[model samples]
Target: MKAEFATAERAVTLGVRETTDGLKMSMRRQVTSAGLGQRMANTWRGDNYPKGQNSIRAAGVVYTKASRIMEGFEDAAVIRSKDGWWLAIPTPNAPKRGVGGKRINPSNFPEHTYGRLRFVYRSGKPSLLVVDNARASYNRKSGQLRGFRKASDRAVSKGSGLTTVVMFWLVPQVQLPRLITFNTEAKRWFDRLPQLILKNWPD
Candidate 1:
């Protein structure tokens, strides 16, 4: 999960007596800038920026640790549950944040904060985790169903507005489509190598 650029080869081509350290620093800046641009593009969810650290310089080579995530943009990826269990896909009604302000999943979901959840199986469709006697209210600002509250006995009675609200969908696998322009950005920065070397040429 890395991209390595041999700085020595480019430095040789440019006939520069500058140190590889200078060129490596220049390349690091460009790679950092490129990563920032991708983050701004809003291709994926959450803050994927720091998940992959900035580029590193080693022995005349500059590389990045963002390969695994960037590779998904180059090709489609099928993600399966790590524990051989169904993947819980959160629904709009599900809480967005869990403990430590991270995205909520079945593992870290605050069930007690919401209500008791039950599984509902479907004959031909994915099974769902739902709250039987809960009510959901929509938030106009976020455009999502939030404010899940337990229904009182009278509210759960007939003609009551309380209904089963879906929290998550259980699926075996999920296929992620190609979204980011990783190769394009890589080539762009690669093409600028000559200029970068000159810019950071040893003073």
Candidate 2:
């Protein structure tokens, strides 16, 4: 697969202080284009983690975004995000039916994976969330559907013993911003759209 991504500078810190809308926090955004199976990896890899360090990203997002180095290797950091939502840059790897390691049902994919999206601004802050029936974003080719992640897809407890949780973007509305989603079958945690999870990963 092929991917194209660009970083955007100059993000605004909307609420670190205050706002006309009285919204709190900051908003940073950059547009990226990933080929069918590319762009899964974050732009800032290798610089931090070693090669083939991709699988870890998925495990990490199950917790939170922007990991901060809490201990262990300098690369080991605590995940964090500015907005109420978590922001993570998953390292891209090959696609598969099961993840980390587990079998899955062929149905309940994009069709039933995501749906019932709703969004609104709290305290004048512009925010949004999306509901996707697509458990995971799959290449819309004829036979490639299965190649995409299925609802039954899973990330097995590995040498590290990490649980593979999925993450997806929320519904986007004109009054609200669209939450960008990542992960195949990442919608499993859809009910708790932005309920930030702090993962104390063993380094």
Question: In terms of TM-score, which candidate is strongest?
Answer: 1
Candidate 1: stretches off by over 4 Å: 1-66, 138-146, 157-159, 192-203
Per-prediction TM-score: 0.57, 0.17
State residue 67's C-alpha deviation in candidate 2, in Å. 15
List model 2 lDDT by residue over 1-203, tens digit each: 12111111001111111121111011111113222112322322212122223222222122222322111112333444545453322212222322324332112223233333334334544343333222434466653433223233333222222222232222222121222333222343332222221122111
Cα error of candidate 2 at position 159, Å: 44
Q: Give the TM-score of candidate 1.
A: 0.57
On lDDT, the leading prediction is 1
* Candidate 1 least-lDDT 10 residues: 44-53
